[model samples]
Target: MSGKVFLAGAAGAVGAALTPLLVESGYEVYGTTRRLERMDAIRAAGARPVLVDIFDRERLANAIDCIAPMIVVHQLTDLPPGLDPTRMSDAVSRNARIRGEGTANLVSAALAAGCECVVAQSIAWAYAAGAKPYTESQPLDLGSEGARAVTVVGVAALERWVLGVNETGGVGTVLRYGNLYGPGTGRDTPQGASPLHVEAAAWAALLAVQHMKGGAFNVAEDEAEVTSEKAKREFGWLPDMRLPAQAAQ
Candidate 1:
């Protein structure tokens, strides 16, 4: 908590939820955003904002090196606001690129800066159709077609790079999060095969930074498709957590 934390995609839904927690927990938080206009929001959340594109390897690496954070949290995504149906196809491709090429760039940058121990965001719905409650060990839906295949491939790439970082003295922890729904995420209530509150998703990343042992953990509610028991046992992450409506008086 004393050291700095480099948060990628700090203006994102989960990032917006996470920045405040990191600041309150005593970490020097450095957050990234591509849009200059969003810097104020990052600052309001108590994080030093850096403007950089995740796709720009050189710039991102420079940003990371400049901050020299001890922990890196990957929460980048390219989804359209509210997941507009008209924009979903394009967003899917962009999001896939983020999970694949973008993750590679981030990992390279983190390693160069001697910053190990990454807690990355991934989805819980990518598991193949085999069991009722999919565990972390289940194979991804690699054989699927169309958009689902694109998603699975991207998720697989991201996980591989994150976990493989441990081979070179760095540790990678993957939180296979369920569909995030909460304030700032456009969903005030749960929706999807496995719903998760955005606050709980952010909390899971925070817990992983301090307690996780560098592997995949399903972060979801008590859903039928995915199980979060591992995260509960390992990181004490509860899917029911939500941001308080009012500050403590």
Candidate 2:
């Protein structure tokens, strides 16, 4: 409970919400951001700020090596604020790259640093078309076309890299989060098929860090799109969970 934790994408929505939780739970957190302007925000959230791009393998590896955290959390993404419609095409491609290449670099660095566990972010809406509620065992929509295809492919790669690390004696937990809303996210109310509050998503990541179990879990509200029962039973997560007002600040 009192070890080092390296959080990638510490300036992000979920990262911002999860940082204080990690700190309060007794972890020494080192958080990464690509922009110098975001460094203070990370520090304000109770973590030491580390400026390193996820795509910069050498620099990222060096940063993780210096910290030698017991746990590494992957919450990186490349989406624009509010998910602007006009820029979605470009955002999707960039985000796909983040999920693909960025994840590879992070897992590699985590392994090199001898991390005991890694918890990564994924999406719940990528399940292949079929049933009303998809389970973790369901296949991703790998055969889809256009933007969705790009996303699914990237999700698959990220999941493979994250889960495959378990074979090396490290625990890998992937949380397939639903469409996130709430603070830091553009939407104040729920949005998308399986809407999830940003704080609840952050809470799930904290649970994953605490659980140290390897496998995927759908983290979302009770909805037809996906089932979050696994996370609820395993991690005691609740979709309604939210950070206290002070902690949120």
Candidate 3:
């Protein structure tokens, strides 16, 4: 909880919720945003702001090297605001690229920086269609057509790269979060399948970074779509938690 922690995608919804948590937890937080305009927001959240694109391997590596963080958090995504239906197809493709290629770059950067652990964001709804409450061991829906197929493939690649890095000495933890709602995210209340608060999603990442044992964990409410018992037992995490009033703004 007291290391120099580097957070990728730190201007995104969950990232915005997480920055203050990391700072409050006494971590020397370095938050990243691709847009230079977001540096002030990151800084205001009590983190050192870094501007680096996840697609730019060299810049990301340099940023990580400069920060020398012990923990690296991957929250990168390219989805449009409110998940605009008209733009969803393009967003899916872009987001998949972020998951696949962006994840590769982040892993390489973390490894080069000698990071001890990496905590990454993933989705809970990617499981194959047979289960009620899917666990971490369930297979992803790899055979689906169109957008789902793209997402599943991208997710598989991201998980493989992250978990594989553990063999070389860096521990990897993946938090498969349910659909996020709450502040900064478009939804203020639960809406879709396995609805999760954005602050809860951020809390899961914080728990994963602090206490995970190098494997995937489902992070959701006590609903039937996904199970978060493992995260609760292992990290003592609770999904109902919210950020402070100031941070939520």
| Best-performing candidate as measured by lDDT | 2
Q: Give one digit per residue, the lDDT tens place, for model 1 in 1-249.
A: 568999998899999888888887888999999999999999988899999999999999998998887899999999888877899899888989999999999988998998968889999999999977899999999999999999899999999999988788778999999988876677778889889988899989989988747999999888547999999999888887765553110
Error of 2 at 208 (Å): 0.4
Write the residue-wise lDDT of candidate 3 on 147-217 in tens digits: 89999999988898888878887799888989888877777788767889999899888878778579888
Which scores greater on TM-score, model 1 or model 3?
A: 3
Give RMSD to native, each candidate: 1.6, 0.8, 1.1
TM-score comparison, 2 vs 3, better candidate: 2
lDDT scores of the candidates, listed in order: 0.89, 0.93, 0.88
lDDT of 2 at 66: 88
Show where candidate 1 strays beyond 4 Å: 244-249
**What's model 3's lDDT at 52?**
85
Off by over 4 Å in 3: none
**TM-scores for all predictions:** 0.96, 0.98, 0.97
Total backbone clashes of model 3? 0
